[model samples]
Target chain A: SQTIHQWPATLVQPVGSPLSLECTVEGTSNPNLYWYRQAAGRGLQLLFYSVGIGQISSEVPQNLSASRPQDRQFILSSKKLLLSDSGFYLCAWGGTSGIYEQYFGPGTRLTVT
Target chain B: AQSVTQLDSHVSVSEGTPVLLRCNYSSSYSPSLFWYVQHPNKGLQLLLKYTSAATLVKGINGFEAEFKKSETSFHLTKPSAHMSDAAEYFCVVSDRGGGGADGLTFGKGTHLIIQP
Candidate 1:
């Protein structure tokens, strides 16, 4: 069985501070990773996705960026956080064959004050 | 371009009643559809997916959705609504071009409220 883990379950930061959220998947190799943001009561907004190491595609342009430093390690980072960046950040992973389902991590709730 | 629309923003149903949440999609290619449930303060969970397999896709927790290509709709339904079923449901469309782990477009979401 595969398991996804995320750190700093919740965080409170002042605006203009740096932000770093980590996601990792165990028991799977070369999996597809994604980062998404969900507002209070809205759908998910895709931020970035990684197909392989050092390869990332960003969907919406913003202050945040994502990196696949390792096969199973995906990090979402920002040099400076904005008030608008306050939301629930989620990480997901999927297989490479046929797409049917995606497994998600617990998620990081970041509040930029 | 592919997009999804969830017809309802909020649906209230009494426990033990039937549940129906409507969803319609627009896709260029043979699209894949999915239903996800998000509980408060919890990550999104995959309820079910439709990929040209069975038109009726059964998911966890006794949830199921029907894919109607003629209507371009994938409506989720449950014969009986449970109190635990109260949550936010999202209709999602995936980009087949994104491979298995590509991109998914989500609807605004329908909040399922259960009346005791």
Candidate 2:
């Protein structure tokens, strides 16, 4: 079975502060990774997705960016956080073949005060 | 472009009653649809998916959804509503071009309220 792990379950930062959230998947190699944000009461919005290491596609223009440092490790980062950046961030992994279903991590709650 | 629409923003159902959450989608190709549940402050859990397989897909917790291609609808239902079922439900549609690289489009969500 594969498991996805996210670090810093919850965090509170001030505007203009830097942000870093890490996601790692175990039991799977070369999986597709994705970063999604869910606002207070809105549905999830895809921020970024990576098909392989060092390859990332941004779904929407935002204050954050993503990087796939390793085959199973993905990181979402921001040089400076904004109040609007506060939300629940989720990491997901999917298989490379077919219309594979995505598995989501526990998620990180970010509050930018 | 693919999109999903959850018909109800919020639905209230008494416990022991049938549960229904409506969803409709639009896609250029054979669409892959999914239903996910989200507890308060928790990540989304896959309920079921329709990928040109069986029209009726069964999922976790006795929940099921039927894919109606003619109507472009995928409505989720449960025989009996449980208090634990009180959560937000989402309808998602994957890109027709295929591949995990394409992100899914999610519905705003329907808040399911199970009343005792």
Candidate 3:
């Protein structure tokens, strides 16, 4: 069975600080990875997605970026965080084949103060 | 382009009562739809999905959803509501031909409340 892992489970960052959230999937290779943000009282918004290593697609323009360093490792990063950047960050993976359902990780809660 | 709309923001139902969360979607062509549940501060868990297959899809935890293409609707239902079912439900639409590189559009969500 395949499983996804993300950390740190929770994070507190100061304004203008750097941000880094990691996501890794085990038992799968060349899977599609995605990053989404769920703001308070709002639905989730897709931030970025990657089909393969070194290939990242941005769904929306924001203060963050994504990178797939390895076939199973994806990272979400920001040079400087903003108050609006605070939200629940989720990492998801799907098969490279046809349109399939995605599986989400436990998620990271980031609070920018 | 594709979009999803959840009819209710909050729904309250007594325990053991039937659960129905309405959802409507718009797509250029045949699209994939899904229902996901989110607990407080947790990630979304897929409840059911409709991907050009069975009209009625059964999911985990006694939850199911029916795909009504005529009405452009994919409504989620439950035979009996449980206290644990009191969480936010989301309707999602995906029209990408293939691969997860395409992002999914999510509904604002319906907050299901269970009355003891």
Q: Highest DockQ: give the candidate number.
A: 3
Model number 2 iRMSD:
1.3
lDDT of 3 by residue, B1-116 (tens): 78899999999999999999999999886788899999998888988888899999999999999989899999999999999999999998888763346647789999999999
Q: Residue A101 deviation, candidate 2, in Å? A: 1.8
Please report how far candidate 2 places residue A23 from its true position, in Å: 0.4
Runs in model 3 deviating more than 4 A are B98-100
DockQ values per model: 0.67, 0.71, 0.75
How would you encode candidate 1's per-residue C-alpha lDDT over B32-93 as one tens digit per residue? 89999999888888899998889999999999999999999999999999999999999998
Q: Against the correct fold, how does model 1 do in TM-score?
A: 0.96
Clashing pairs in 3: none
| Alpha-carbon TM-score of each model against the true structure | 0.96, 0.96, 0.96
Question: Per TM-score, what order, best first?
Answer: 2, 3, 1
Per-residue lDDT over A4-57 for candidate 1, one digit per residue giving the tens place of the 0 to 100 score: 999889999999999999999998889999999997867888899999999999
Q: Candidate 3 on A1-113: residue-level lDDT in tens?
A: 88999999999999999999999999887999999999899888889999899999998998899999999999999999999999999999984567467889999999999
Question: How does each model score on lDDT?
Answer: 0.90, 0.91, 0.91
Per-residue lDDT of B32-63 in model 2, one digit per residue for the tens? Answer: 88999999988889999888889999999999
